[model samples]
Target: MIAIGWVKVSVCFILSSLLVACTPVTPPHTEYDWKLPKGFPSPLVPEDNPMTTAKVVLGKTLFFDTDLSFNQSTSCASCHQPKFSFSEPKKTAVGSTGQKHRRNSQSLVNVAYNSNLTWAHSGLNTIEQQILIPMFSEDPIELGITGHENEVLLRFEKQHYAQLFKDAFEDSQASYDKIVKALASYVRSLTSFASPFDEYAYQNKDGAMTDAAKRGMELFFSEKFECFHCHGGFNFTQSSQHENQRLDLRPFHNTGLYNVDNMGAYPLSDQGLIEVTLQNTDMGKFRAPTLRNVEVSAPYMHDGSLATLDDVIEFYAAGGRGQGINNPLKSPFLTGFELQLAQKQDLIEFLQSLTDHQFLNSNLNYPPVSH
Candidate 1:
């Protein structure tokens, strides 16, 4: 009886051990190894579309797929070219079906950090919201998919893309919501961290930037130019809204790109923030994009008015249009400032230092292939 009781106790102990071992443990998520520069805050990843290698890969394929559009001619890459800091050099982007969009294609560099997107529309805060406009807007006809939703889906359903949609969503189907989420995930993952400025400033490395760049950095932060006031911070954007951002969200700025009618207005058609709000105070206001890759992301400005970094410096130095006249909304900060020839050159050099060649040529190209 003693031996039998001992055997029962041993069996119970073995069964308890097996139960503990078989239980599934939620292992730490080590998927994305984000390596941001020092002083750079973590990017705001959305809750619904969590970062995963699989999702990013899927998103890249979707981003470059011309089939996403109604006519099967244009993809997301049409406007946001990878070579030009993911921004087209066009004054206004031409759509898939030959329609021209009003605004210039905004840069994708560090856009995951933007609080507000687009020249107008203060409320379109998330990348997901910003994406739907191009995909479905009819007046402009970006993707030209206003009434061809079924046709678009049908094309994807014919091939492996249907399966790809399932993999990205972890469901057996792909909806517009899932498509947008996947594309946004890929956009957020296009973070640039290896710029020369990042190396010299954050990594504390010597001579990572040229002497001209060092001089330009001085001019950028100097009291004369005061470039840092608006184009400051780790992301080099005024539209930052993350927790550790040093300053509050100062998304809009009137850079004096237009005063077409001399009524303190931007071009009537391209009226910046006022288009959405219909408020005078919001006139000519647009979100400030990150200057991280500004050197390549030209022609500059919300309308692509300024063609080059040199032109940009010239615009700011001249203090915008109607410099002599005082516009009420012109941020008291951007009042006409004088910069010398060498100083301007140095500033341009500094802007160039922000270009990360590695990020620009990153091999994570469009269309995922098998491992």
Candidate 2:
């Protein structure tokens, strides 16, 4: 009887060991180091797609990979170059199929702090949603990958990407949803806060900004210039938010760039927020982008109408073009102000001081090598 009981116990133990061996063990989740700049608040991250080092690494690879395009000719990096603060030098971005985009590609610097993703769309609240437009939209065909989803997936299944996807996501399927999430993670990590302006303003570093730039900084935030009304805050934009922000601000202004019929009418093709809201009052209203890297992001404005920072400053000083017709829809802050030639040069220097050379050449922002 003792021998029989021992045999039964041994059999049960063996069965339990087999069951435990067959069950898959989930790997531990990786915690990402945000490396947020001093005086900058944390960027709000999505709950579903938490930031992880693995995801960021995978996203960077996908961002520079041409395979995401239908013809395998272009990638997100083609339009948003790192040297220019992730903004293209062209007036407007040219798509993968050589289609010209009507709107200029906005800079992605500190994009994680933006409440709304695009120049006019308040609905595009997240990078995950905004990325879909450039990748598959047929109206302009940026990546032209709408019908080639399967082909793209197959391309991603190549040895290099397959391993990356598996390591990042724990599943190597290379699905579209995973790609979007990873790309968004990489973009959100492109933060710039080591500029001369930041060093002086936030870090208490003396002589970080030149005397000319110091004077310009005062002018930029002064009530007389009204520059702060639109491009204010640490990120230098009114339409900005960080994790500590209690309210999300989506301020849009009609800077009187155009009044086609003297009726606050913008160009028929691009009517700014009116395209989404269908409100006449909303016509020509566009979101103010961050002026952090404005020095390098030339061909300024939503449509790249202003070719240089000088042109931009002049446009504001003159209270914007066609202001007589579009004044009603323009922001109250657009009342013109005078600046001496010296002051103008100082202001330009101030803007240039906002450029962070470290960020422009950061190894983390660059494309990853294939292993």
Candidate 3:
């Protein structure tokens, strides 16, 4: 599933009220060095599972270890590989036993900032809670840990894991709780802010972006383009929430992907949020993922139906998918746009600038050497 696909520095700090502060800022949790980029706020973390070096190490090891799977055939990296911005090349996810998933596996980049989890769920917010679907859910049987929980857990009782457990939880024992907590910690650590856009925007390095990319950036933020309405903010998404966030904006939109009855109904296999809330208005709705590292994390959209960035652009330019264009549930922002050939290429070049090579290192996917 892991196909080929995918840092810069920034300065400038803002003080409370009117003054500007250049003082070194550190996140409240000190054990883990977030290494956050300048100008970005500290990520909101849950009090129950404070991030730590030991836990991150344990989680990273388990994340890549296929032994964590029921059949030892899959790991978290199977669906989310580091090379593809923590996403995969497959159109959709395939479980350990080759059970096909209903929706596309979204890239996990900057997931810690997401206020909502999954493609449509409004309630599943935390990384710890969302991870349970893969680790234990019997529906699609991702890790297939439901029936074989004890057997799979016992595998981690070895001396190697014993030390890891002890260092992380102050006990030489492993449990589902420890595993979930550690896995969440590792995932929360994945933050990308070294893109050319970051350097140009945050560090004021004008030379960081190409001339065409710069022009495209202007168009992206312009009101006429309206791209920033959903994919806005420092993270390039409206669904983000950081430490300073006060508004609980869990925005989901219907991009008019389907209209089988001319009633804005998406495929029954996966109709987005309507499945959970059972609300008619929520039909064909899905979360707009962060555009960071969007260059590599393709075959896009909730169903992985769009094959390329150009296709996605055309979809938006034409308002929506053919029949769905007239769906009443479609976002008002998707009214359509006139895109010129030159403009399309320029927009793509800007998207390509979002790829962060430094963040795609092997350390996030490969396990450390056994002691």
Candidate 4:
């Protein structure tokens, strides 16, 4: 009886051990690693679609995949190339269907810090909302996937995408929502703060910037130039926000880019914020994009009319391009000022110093390697 009782106890112990060993081990949840620079605030991320390594990886793959386009010829990366700080070399973006976009393709660098997503549209506060226009808008036909939503989703049913979607979302279902969320997550991760200026200003790294750049930085922020009034914050734009920011400021500046008929008209087709707000005072008003990586994102301005940074500096020095047109709706800061030839060069040097070489060549921002 004692031997039988001992045998039963041994059997129970073995069963318990086997059960414990066979139990499934849940993998640790991946924490989103934000490699932000010193003094840079945390990017405001959507609560619904939190950042994750798997999601960012999946987003990168999808961003580069031409399958999202109807003709399989263009992807998000087509317009926003990593070589140019996620901004194309074209003055204005050309869509997948060969249609020309009215506005220039804004750079995605530090886009997560932007309170407003696009140039003029104030309603597009989130990346998810802003992405829908590019992917589905028939007016510009960016990706040309308007009516072929199912076809686009069907492309993701392949084994590779299926696995990726499952890993990223913890579900294999490929939906439009999932696509936008993942894409937005990837775009938000396109932060650029490792510039020479950042090193000199925030990192306490001496000799990171040249004397010309340092002088230019002073001029840019000085009351004489008043450049910082619009492009002031750490992101170098007033229309910026971060996780710590209590108030989101979406400021639109009317730089008097145009003043047709002296009525502050900005070419009927591209009337800036007036198109959205229908307010006469809002004419020619557009969000000032971050000056970060401005060296690479040439052909500056909302319309990409300014060919070079030199021209841009001259335009500002002259107050605006509309010399004769007395536009009252222009920003109060548009008071003309004189900048010496050497001072202009210094300003240009300062702008160039903001170029983040590390961000431009980041492997993670590039297309994923094909299997």
Q: If the candidates were sorted by their TM-score against the true structure, best first, what order would they fall in?
A: 2, 4, 3, 1
lDDT of each: 0.77, 0.84, 0.84, 0.84
Question: In the order shown, what is each candidate's alpha-carbon RMSD?
Answer: 6.6, 5.7, 12.7, 6.7
Residue-by-residue lDDT tens digits, candidate 1, 112-138:
887787766788889999899889988
In model 3, the Cα lDDT at residue 148 comes to: 95
Output the worst ten-in-a-row residue range by lDDT, candidate 1.
Answer: 21-30
List, residue by residue over 242-343, the lDDT tens digit for candidate 2. 344333345787888887777677888788998888877788889988998888888898899899999888888888785433566777678778878998
Report model 2's TM-score to 2 decimal places.
0.90
lDDT digits (tens) for residues 147-248 of candidate 4: 998888898888988899998988888999989999999998888889999999889987999999999999998878878877978888884343443332
Which residue pairs show backbone clashes in model 3?
none
Index of the highest-TM-score prediction: 2
Model 3's TM-score against the true structure: 0.88
The TM-score measured for candidate 1 stands at: 0.86
Local error of candidate 2 at 131, Å?
Answer: 0.5
Clashes of each: 0, 0, 0, 0
C-alpha root-mean-square deviation, candidate 4:
6.7
Whole-structure CA lDDT of model 2? 0.84
Q: Give the Cα RMSD of candidate 2.
A: 5.7
